[model samples]
Target: MKKRLDLAAFRDGILSGSRVVLGQAITLVESALDSDQELAAELIQSLMSHTGRAIRIGITGVPGVGKSTFIEAFGKMLLEKEKKVAVLAIDPSSQLTKGSILGDKTRMESLASDKRAFIRPSASGGTLGGVSGKTSEAMLLCEAAGFDVILVETVGVGQSETAVKNMVDYFLLLMLAGAGDELQGIKKGIMEMADALVIHKADGENLPSAKKAKASYQNALHLFPSSPKDWSPKVSLASSLSGLGLEETWREVLRYEYQMKESGFWESNRARQRINWLDEQIHYLLGQAFLRDSKVKQTMDHEMENVRTGILNPGTLAKKLVSLFLSTERPQ
Candidate 1:
């Protein structure tokens, strides 16, 4: 086993922006061990005052939407403006093997090597939202490390977009022009959640179509109900290769931040997100406890087989398991 750091060591290392310690601290939080979790919680509590300063932006879209490329360009741009950036890229894990490529660092070579930027790629671990379960914690750690911008790049499939939206101050959806029926290429719900729609790869011969797609998206956005914050989502074309619209995209983010802060929605939204996080944690803890119960573990396979064979109802088995779990003796 790797030697564990005391709470003070973890806390001080993270606050002092020690990259090695920061990585180890993130690993500690992501660990499944009970001792590590206890320490991780203490570290987070100690650093609470230092977090929530960075602008959290989640970028996601369909496969091949150039998410990594866009983030690299955007991160580099932020660095140019003398801003510190941290990227939390979530990679999908294979269901059969439970292994992940964790290739974001490889994909974003330049940005990963930069001193002003930090990139941490995590495996989704079959999480439904294209994000790892510990992503929010990692974001807080990054914020505490003095990153001005936190970019969360999701797997861009299924419910990943919605999952990311809840944790971020801004949601950026990247789309490819001429991929299919412009509006039909992605779900309406995902589009509605975006604070900005970026038509990526808008360079060379694709610029015109990207521009056309921009207009289409702009019109479509107008038809949706107005946002509660009274801020309209902006659609723009960007090319990661030629650096088109990168600055404009940052400007929109800043403008949205200003407008939302002015209207008091920024803090309110973050408050709501915290509550949601609490609820999710409750559910996760309950589930973990249920699975770890000795009695439940002893009967789970039998009950599952019975259910598979239609000998027991799933709901009945679930209730039975819960009862067994709750009835199990606990050490007070």
Candidate 2:
């Protein structure tokens, strides 16, 4: 089994145009079991030695913003331009039953049929830490699979999809028209992270509303300092169903890419992502290792009870757990 899951052979398969193997590797990486997770991280480390090729994009939206439909249309448009696109969608709702109402493949029908595009649903397995911490590795596998563009669609919780944004070259946030809570849904902090915001369903009777929404977003965006990218975040209108403004949206994405590259922010940002990925993985594995301790397990069960009983503060309790954990370290 170890030989079968060997990272070197898997690396070769990805480089040799075997997308199936690449997909399987991502599945392994996204697994929740400890053994599988360790093997996955090992494989990803081997593959990371050959990195920095694909353009990673993270797309996030509030619920009902038509993200899946927009991805379908946008993917079709990318394939038209002869670009290979890979989409990894993280839907938190898959936690309970491992079920998705409209899984990425089913929702993005056209892209699913397109040979140049690959769409995979999140095998989140109840871990919301960006698909059990496999998202970054899966992205690397997608890049090795020769997809020039990768879109990571994050959970629509509107909380801190910040993890996805930190991994990608450009981040796109989608919004709807006449939502009444659009402004409230998109706080200044979240909007500031966006490279571009697209008002979806901008066709037929909704055109005017989309325009209004776009103007409002644009005005709101101007109030914040410019994004890390040299170009200011742009707001556009697009009808994913009618395919209106789809081309312009892609063009603006490319424009943002080029502008960032010209300003040297592109390379710097990617390097920063690499460092962050390393730090995050280290943090995750250490936490996992700490949890393996029997004392840690007992402490966890005890800490929650203490919190519930108001006998201990969360921060101080957490520090005690960590202190005990460090002091009780065994074999490395």
Candidate 3:
């Protein structure tokens, strides 16, 4: 038999700032087993008061924009300011084998080795928006562990940015300079959602182009409607290698936070996000229940074959499975 988890021990270790315990707690929440999930829920609920103190920031960009390196530099800057930082780097998982590279720790060796920084590379597991299903939970755990800042790095493969944006206080979009038509590289919707834009690799010969890109993006952002928070998104240049513009980026984040909080939008937005989280949980639980229903499981293979052979339409088979699943809950 497996050893049971000690919830109190885990909670105490996390509150006391034990990195090992924090990592284990995060792993518990990431587990798919029903037993582990129950424990994870209890752990999260118990630590609810400690969470939400950290500034949650979502960072996304085009591939090759150097997100991991940028995070290392940015995180190190925060550490210099006597702040604890947690990075949740979401890695793209393979569709065939479901394996992920999980190499952010390796790429961010300096930051990973820092005693004040926590780097977690989680597999996306085919989740839309390039974020793992348990990412928000992980963020909560990190916040509970007393991290002053939480940085969520998305897979940045043109997936929906809404998921990360909704969970974060600031949404940062990193862009590469001299990369073909800059405006055409990403969806305008993603741009509109950004709290700030940083043109990375703004050193050496790339400096000029980075500046030009910043100007172009600044102009484009002017056309979009102002955010409800009454804050304007700014575009700036940064270089992870030379450590340029890191402080400015941090200042921008603080400015946005200060402005939003002063206007009461910060608290209201977080409340709205919590409600959205509840809705997502409901849908997720309903899907899980539907899949686990004995009737649905027994007939699923037959229904799939029927649909494959064109004997039954997919919509009809779906409705039939839902009906069967629902009927099981009805009183006999």
Candidate 1 lDDT for residue 298 = 84
Q: What lDDT is obtained when candidate 3 is compared to the true structure?
A: 0.82
Q: Which rank order by lDDT, best down to worst? A: 1, 3, 2
Summarize candidate 3's per-residue lDDT along 94-185 as a digit string, tens digits: 34323222443367788888999998776446444224457888899899999999999876355536778878999999998885646677
lDDT of each: 0.83, 0.78, 0.82
Q: Name the candidate that leads on TM-score.
A: 1
Query: Can you give the TM-score per candidate against the true fold?
Result: 0.92, 0.89, 0.90
Give lDDT tens digits, candidate 2, residues 23-84.
78888876667787777777777777666688888898877888888888898889989999
Please, what's the RMSD in Å of model 2?
2.7
Question: Which number leads on lDDT?
Answer: 1
lDDT score, candidate 1 = 0.83
lDDT of 3 at 108: 79
Name model 2 segments beyond 4 Å from true: 1-5, 33-35, 96-105, 130-132, 313-316, 329-332
Runs with alpha carbons beyond 4 Å of true place in candidate 3 = 1-4, 91-101, 123-133, 156-160, 179-184, 305-315, 329-332
> Residue by residue across 221-290, what tens digits does model 1's lDDT show?
9999998789899999999999999999999999999999999999999999988877777777787778
